[model samples]
Target: MNIKGKTILITGGGSGIGLESAKQFLAEGANVIITGRNSAKLEAAKKLLPSLIIIKSDVENEEDAIALLDKVTSLGGIDILYNNAGVGSPALNLGIANDQILKNAVYEMNVNYFGVIRLNNLFINMLKSRKEAAIINTTSILSLVPALEEPTYAPTKTALSFYTRTLRKNLEILKSNVKVFELLPPVVATEMTANRNDKKITPEQLVKALVSGIKKDQFTIRVGDTKLLYVVSRFFPKLAFNLVNPKKIYASLK
Candidate 1:
């Protein structure tokens, strides 16, 4: 899928990865629409990237997703739907209390899973009608391997990975032109994980890899340590799993 002149809807556009994606897409001359729950954040994005179409939305809410898709598609045909909106919560292995663990799991699932689901469902038809359409889902290294924070985030990515795959399979069954893609990005120097020194890749490097994978030919856009996770997840599930356990391996959050 060509990024130039294409219209793309992005969720979680307030800050971090989502915001960065919006800026990069705009620079590439793609018609970008960004969504977030905070009006202030949306306004801030607008201030920073005036070319962007900003929408205040909570992708976790089904109705909000439907409304957002409707609003954007009505303006013009949608060529790409980048489901970049996501949340990361502490995993049960992080050893938080039971109540916090439950809340964390739910929060992560709501933003990471259902948020993408709602957008995919609503805009799929519109994208199908277009000449060429694509979907880019934001997954993580934990989806393929366990991280100390895996319990909170890995399941959501695992679920999302399956969801994207099934959708692609269904598209084949229906003979649809929509191509699906995923990113297994390693930790980046973003606000969500700025403290980490283990990861050397910058968001620009990751985003560059992302744009390179925007074409339909790309499937899994794995970069940096993320690829290692797949290898580890496959060859040494238990050993790989233990490495990220906060209790057993490293309790240090930073």
Candidate 2:
């Protein structure tokens, strides 16, 4: 599907991959509206790219998601919905248990899983109206290969990946105009991992892959270690499990 002249809405566009992807879409001549929970961050993103349309919002709340859909549709029916909004908790990966895990789990599921489900339903009608409608869901390499460092984040992403695959097949059976897409991104240099020292791909690199995938009408677009994870998860599940197994380094959180 051609991205030019399309109206796209991207969740969590205030920073990292979403921000960069919005930049690329804007460059391609698409009307881009970005939503984030923080007004300052959204404003900063707007300052970085004055061409971008910023909406202060969060995907965790049903009301906020509904309002966002209405606001963007008024400008134009969203030709593409990029469901990339996600967040995780510090306790999720550190072998933490009990109350901490429970508290964090709520946000993780709220943003990672429910976020996509809500957006898909909210924008389904408008997306169907478009000549070429697409929905890009963001997953992670960990979703395929689990890691102790971030367990909650990965499971939610894995669930999302699972949902996207089935959703794609279901849509094809129904012969719907809306396309389901997933991006399994590996370690990227973003605020999401500001403290990490791993040498990962830049935001620009990921954005390029995203645009290319969208142009070619691909369903799953993965890059960097995620590509490796995809291959490993398919070809060598045993070895992949051993590589980043959570049980190994999980020092129980007191």
| C-alpha lDDT score of every prediction, in listed order | 0.80, 0.85
Estimate, for each residue in 210-248, the C-alpha lDDT of model 1 and write its tens digit.
888875468789988777767887888887776545354
* CA-only RMSD, every prediction: 2.5, 2.0
Worst 10 residues of 1 by lDDT: 245-254
Residue 164, model 2, lDDT: 92
Tens-digit lDDT track of model 2 for 1-254: 79999988999999899999999999999989999998998999999999888888889999998888888867766799999888977745344346777767778998999989998988888888877898899988888887666767778988998999998998899899888888888788998788766668998999899899989998899888777767888999988887655454555433
Q: Number of backbone collisions per candidate, in order? A: 2, 0
Candidate 2 off by > 4 Å:
91-97, 245-254
Q: How do all models score by TM-score?
A: 0.90, 0.93
